[model samples]
Target: MTLTQSRRSGGRAARHALRSAPLAENVRPVRGGMTGGTLKALSDDEVLRIHKAALTVLDEIGLADAPPSGIEIMVNAGARLGDDGRLRFSPALVEDMLGKAARNITLYGREPAHDLNLSENRVHYGTAGAAVNMVDAEGRNYRHSTLQDLYDAARIADRLDNIHFLQRPMVARDLPDNLELDLNTLYACGTGTTKHIGTSITEPANAQACLDLAYAMAGGEDAFRARPFVSNSNCFVVPPLKFATESCQVMEACIRGGMPVLLLSAGMAGATAPATLAGAVVQAVAECLAGIVYVNAIQPGHPAIFGTWPFVVDLRTGAMSIGSGEQALLTAGCAQMHQFYGLPGGAAAGASDSKLPDMQAGWEQMCSNVMAGLSGLNMVYEAAGMHASLLGFCHESLILGDDIIGQALRCLKGIEVTDETLAIEAMREVCMGGPGHYLGVGETLARMETDYVYPFHGDRTSPKEWEENDKPDLIAGARARKEAILAMPCRAALNPALDREIRARFPIKL
Candidate 1:
C-alpha cells in the first residue's frame, strides 16, 4: 500500500482509539492559579492578525539572497519579486497555501501505536545544538562521543517523560559518510527505545534507509505507512541567507513522501544578519517562508514546521553565540509567528555557550527554555546537555534539563475549572468550625497530583534526616539519576541478525 493510504487507515484507527480512550488521569485541566495571568496566550484573531502582518512584511520588505528555485516558485504562484530580490506575496495566497497545508501530525514511536500527538497544546522537549562532544553515564565522564554515546543518550531520553522524541545519533561516530552516520544512528535509536525518534538526514539515500528501517519496525510498509512513525525530518537552510540544493532536495523528499519538514534558518546578528533581533527575525521568517512556499508548491498539502535559531554574534569574536538573550527572544517571537501559520513550531532551548556546566549554563538554559515553552512552541529541541552551542553533551545536563522541562510543562497548565478544584465543600467544612478540615480530605488527596510536579531530586526530608543522608546539590542529584537510568536494562529489543548486520556494516574500530 502507498504511504498515503496507510496514513488514512492509521488516522481512522487513531481517531477511534482517541474516541474510546478514557480521560487521562494525569491530564488535568488548567486551573486558576499559577497560569491564570498568562492564560491568554494567543487568540485566533491575534494569530490571524500577526499572519497578515507577516505576509505584508514579506511582500513589501521582501528578502534578498533567497534560493532561486524558491523565488521562482513564489513568483509563479502570484508572488511579486523585485530585481533586487524582494518578494511581495499576497495575503490571500499565503493564507490559501497555509489552509491547504497539513497542520496535524502523529510522530511514530517504536512501540507501533505509541505516538507523540502534535496539534494539541502538548509541549515536547529535547536537546538542541548542531555538534555534540561529551556523553556521561553514571558518574563516569565519557570524553568523546561515539555510537555508544548516541545509544546512551537514547536510553536516557526513553526514560524521561519530558523528552517526547529522540533526535538522531547524539554524536556522529565514524561512518563512511554523514548519511551512513545518520542512518546507523537512527537504527540504533529505533532499537534502543520506544520514544518517538526524529530523523534529520540531508542525503536522500540516508532518508530512504531510515524509511526502510521504519517500515520494517512497523511490521510492513502498509503498517508503517498507516502511521507517521517516520513522518518528520529536519534540515537547515543556509544561515543568514538561502537554501542550498541539498536542503531543497531534503525538503522536497519530505513533503512528497508525506513527512513534515522543519526548516530552520539560523542567522547570527551583526554578522550574518542584521544586528537587531526584530530584523534578524524578519529575515529568518522570510527565509523559512521561502522554503515553505517551495514545499507547498511541490505538494500543496504537505506538512511544514517553522523554526529558527537566530542568535547574536559576539561582537568581539564575531561568532554565533547561543547564550545571547537575543537568541531566546528570537525563539519566543518566532514561536508566535509559527502559531500565526497554524503549524507546529520548532525552536532551540536548553542551550548554553558556557565551556562547562556552571551558573552561566544554568541561567542560559533555564531562561531560554522557559521563554520558548511559555511562548508555546510545539517541540523544543536541545533540551538536554549541550554546551558551547553544540560542542558538548553532559548526562548531568540532561537530568537537570528534565527538571527544567517539568517546570515549563507546569507553566503551560493554563487554568483549571473543575468542581473538585473550587474546593467549596472543603471551605464550608473548614468554616463549620472544623479543626484543619483540609488536612486529610479525599478531595485534597486527589488534588495533590495536579498541584505539583514531584521533583526527581532535592531533599524532601527533615533537617536531621537530611543531615544523616549527604546533603547533595542539584548536580550530585542529577549524577545519581543518570546512574540509576544507565543501570536499567534497555527497553527496545533488537533483531539479532539485523543488529549483527548493522554492527558489521558500521563497526567501531577503537
Candidate 2:
C-alpha cells in the first residue's frame, strides 16, 4: 500500500481500539446523555442528499479562477474551466473526491489522554485566534497579549466545560522571533490545559514545528504515529476566488502527515467578492473546492474540515460587518453546502462587530450561533468574545457567549419519545388531580443536570436577594469567575524539563 493508504489503515485501527477501550476514569460521558436532539445527527441518507446538492450547485452555478494546479486537475478529470476562469465540475467528479475523502478524525493533545472526536454530528468550540487585545482585571483593554495572557486564557477556557479546544492567538509583541513565539505559545497551552490545543499552520516552517512539538509531546514518533494532532491551515483567495502556493503546501502537508486540516476561507462580500451574498458564497465554495482537490490529489483519503466565514460589506460604509443577518445566513448556507460533500463542516458563530458587551453583541452572537447549530455544523469557532473583527476580547463577552451556546445546545435537544416524556399515563394521573407527581420525583432531578446549564453570571435569584447582594453586573461577576479559575491548579501533565524549557523560552518581562 502507498504511504497515505497505510496511514489511513492505521488511523482506522486506532479509532477501533479507542472505541473498544474502557472509559478512562477521568473521561465522563457527555451530560444529558449522547442521544436525542432537534439536530437529528446527519445520517447516511442526509449526508448523501447534501452531497448531491453541492454537486448540483457546483455544476450548474460553476466557480471562477482557482489555482492553475487545481484547475488543471479538474479539467483532466473531465471538469470544465471557462476562458473567464470559471471552473465547473460534474456530479461524477465530486463523487470521486467524496469517495476518497476521510470523514472522521481524532485530535491529540499534550496529554495523551486529551483528545476529541471530529465526526458528522459532533460539535466543538475554541477561542478566537488572531485577536490583539484582551480585557484585563481593571476592565481596561490592553494593546498586546503577553505569554501570561495566553496561559491565563487557556486556564480559564480549560475550567469551562463549554470550550472544547484551546487556540493560539497572536504571539506577544515582545517576542523577538516569530517561530519561537508560535512554538512557545502552543507549548504553554498544551502544558497548561487538559483540553486539546488547536494551532494554525500559516507557514511551512511553522507547520513542521507544529508536527515536531506533537511528536515530542506524544512521547515519541510512535505515540505521535498512534495519535495525530489537529490544526487549521487557511488561504486567502482574493475577489475572484483562487488558492495560493502556501495554502496548497499546507494542505499537502496535512494530507501527507494524516492530520486533520480545517480548510477555512474568509471572504468579504461586495469588496473581495461579488456585491451579492449568493455570489460571495459561490466564490467561497469554489475556493474551498480548490483546497479539497489539492488535498485529495496528495492523499485521496486524507481527513479535512470544510470551513467558511463569509461576511458582508456594508454598502454605505464599505466596511466588513460581522453583525449582519447576511453573516448568519452565509454560515448556515455554507454548512448545507459542505454537507453536500459528505464532509464535516466548520463555521464561525457567536461573534459580533460591537466593541463592547451590549445589546447588539448579544443579538448578533445569539443569531449567528443558533443558525450554525440548527444548520448542523460539526465545529464552530469564535464562539466567544471577539469584537471588531479581531480587536477587542472581554471576559463578560465570553460569559455571555457561554450562555448563548447553552441556548443553542437546548435547541439541539430533540424531543424525547420515552413513555414518561410522552406522559400518556401521567396525563391521566393529572386529570385525576394527582399533581402529576413528576415535580417531586427523582427522575426529574436527574434530568435537570443534563437539561439545564446554570448561568455563571446571570442572576438566577429573586430581585430582593440580588439587590441585597449589591446588584453586581455581568462583567464584574465574570471577572471574579476568571480570577477564581486562574487560581485553581491545572491537572495537565508535562515533562519537568520541557515545561522549564517552554517557560524559559517565553518569560514575562514585567
Candidate 3:
C-alpha cells in the first residue's frame, strides 16, 4: 500500500487498489493553506456582542460541580467563589488566561505527512462520535458496533484523503467493562491507522493505562510526549454550566500524562443551552473559555483545543436538528469565536440526521462541512461517517463523505485570480490564434489533476455510457471500495514484541 493509504494488517485485496488508485496527494487540499471564509454568518459587532455575553455568563453565573482539586486549580488562577459557591471569573481573568493558553497546536500523526498545524484558520476534518449502532448500509439495518467495526472504520479513514484525522467514532458495545473498552479503543485505533487519533477515557486510571500503552509504542515516555499521536477528547462540562467531575479528572490525568486535550463543551441548544442560536454559541464559548483557564491553570501554555461543539434542537419536536440550517450557523459562529480568541478550537460539522446516505444526507453533511471549512475552523469533528443523528455510523457513508469534504475544502480554497490563472494568453491562443478549444491544450491537461478534485466513487458518465458500463451504483461502489481496503494487509502496526507486550500487559480483546 502507498504511504498515504490507510494500511490494514493481514488480509487479501489490501494491495488491490494500490497500483490502480491515484495518489492521495494528487487531490488532497494543501494543509494549512485553505482560505474559504468569504461569507460571514455573524458580523464583527454581533460576534463581539456574543463574546461579551459569554464573558458575562462566566463573570456572573459562574459554573457548578467542580471537583475539589479542580476548584483549587481555578481558585488559584484568578477565579473566585461566588455567594452560591460556583467558581466565577471576571472579564480580566478570562482575558489574562487566554494569553497564557497555546495559540498554535500541532496534532501529530504517527507519520510526519499526517501532522496538522492548527493555526491561522487552517481547517482539518475528521471523525468523532460515540455511536452505539452501526448502520449496515447493505442490509439497511442497525446493529451494535463492535471492536472490529472500529478497526475497519479506522482503516477506511486512513485511506480517505480528505479525512484529516481519526477520532473514536463508534463505541465497542461488545466490551461491557469501561476500563477494558477505553484501553481497547486506544489499541484498536492506534493499530488500525497511523493518523492522529482523538478519543475519551471513562476514568482517570484508564487514561493512565492508555498512556502506558502509548509509551511502549513510542519506545519511551518522552518520545510519546514529543510526538503524541493520541489526544483526549474530554467533555469537561455538562451544559447549563457544570463541570463533569469524572471527565474533569480524566482531563487532568491526560494533561499530566503528556497527552493533548480537546476541551469539549457540547451544549444541546434549546435544551442544555439557550434556545436561540446566538445564545447557544455564547454558552458554548463560555464553557470552553472556562476550559482554557482550567487547562492553563494546570500547566501554563500546555496544548488544549477549545472545543465549542453546540448542537441545534428542533424545539418544535425537541429532536437534535444536526442536519438543519441552524446547525451550520452554530458551527460557523463557534468557529468565529475561536478565531476571536486566536486559539486552536473544534466544532461539529458534516453530521447528518438522515437514516441513510441519500440525498438528504448529502445536503445535510455538505452544508455544514462547507460552512465549517469556509469559516476556517481549526478542527472539525464528526465531519464524516455518521448517521441517524449521531446514533449510528455507516462505513459506506464515511467513504462517501471523503468526496464531500474534498469538495468543501476546494470551495474554501477559493479562486486565485493570478495573471497565469487569469489565462489571458491561453484564452487568446484558443479564441483567435488557435483551434478555439481549450480541451486539448497543454494548460488544460496540466491543471486537470491540480485545479479539479476528482472523486473515487462519483459517477459522471453520460446516460448511454452509463448504460454501457452497466449503470454504476454509488452505494455498491462504496461497498466494493470498503471491501478492497479491509482486504489489505495491515501496514500501520506495532512492532511484534511491543504488540505481544501490550497484549500481555492488558486484556486486548481484538
lDDT (Cα, 0-100) at 464 in candidate 1: 66
Instruction: Report lDDT (CA) for all predictions.
Output: 0.66, 0.65, 0.89
Output candidate 1 Cα RMSD: 10.6
Put down candidate 2 lDDT per residue, 52-140, tens digits, no spaces: 55457677766665556666766776678777677777767766776777776666655554566666556666665567776553545
lDDT of 1 at 339: 64
- Give the local distance difference test score of model 3: 0.89
Model 1 lDDT per residue over 1-510, tens place:
789968866975774564344435445322111121132234556545545555666667655554566667767876787777666666676666677666766566667435655573446677545455674434544466677667777788777766667766356545547866766676667776787777677575566655665666666667765665554455546655545556666656566555566777777778877887767776777667766666777777665667766677788987658876777877777777776666766778778888666789878887877777777777777866777666778767777777666776676664467886677888987768866668656766566555656555534667864785676677778777777988998887567675665556553231
TM-score-superior candidate, 1 or 3: 3
TM-score of each: 0.80, 0.80, 0.94
Best of the candidates, lDDT: 3
Runs in model 3 lying further than 4 Å from the true structure: 1-33
Worst 10 residues of 2 by lDDT: 28-37
lDDT tens digits by residue: candidate 3, 1-510:
554333432221443344245646635334433554566888999999999999999999999999989999999988998778799989999999998999878999988888989877889999999999998988888999999999999999988878989999999999999989998998899888899998889987687788888887777899999999999999999998999999999999988989999999999999999999999999999999999999999998889998999998888998988999999999998888888889998899999999889999999999999999999888989999899889999999999999899888888888879999999989998999798899869888667656766666887657975896799988999999999999988767788998998899988999
* Candidate 1 overall lDDT versus native: 0.66
Which 10-residue window in model 3 sums to the lowest lDDT?
Answer: 4-13
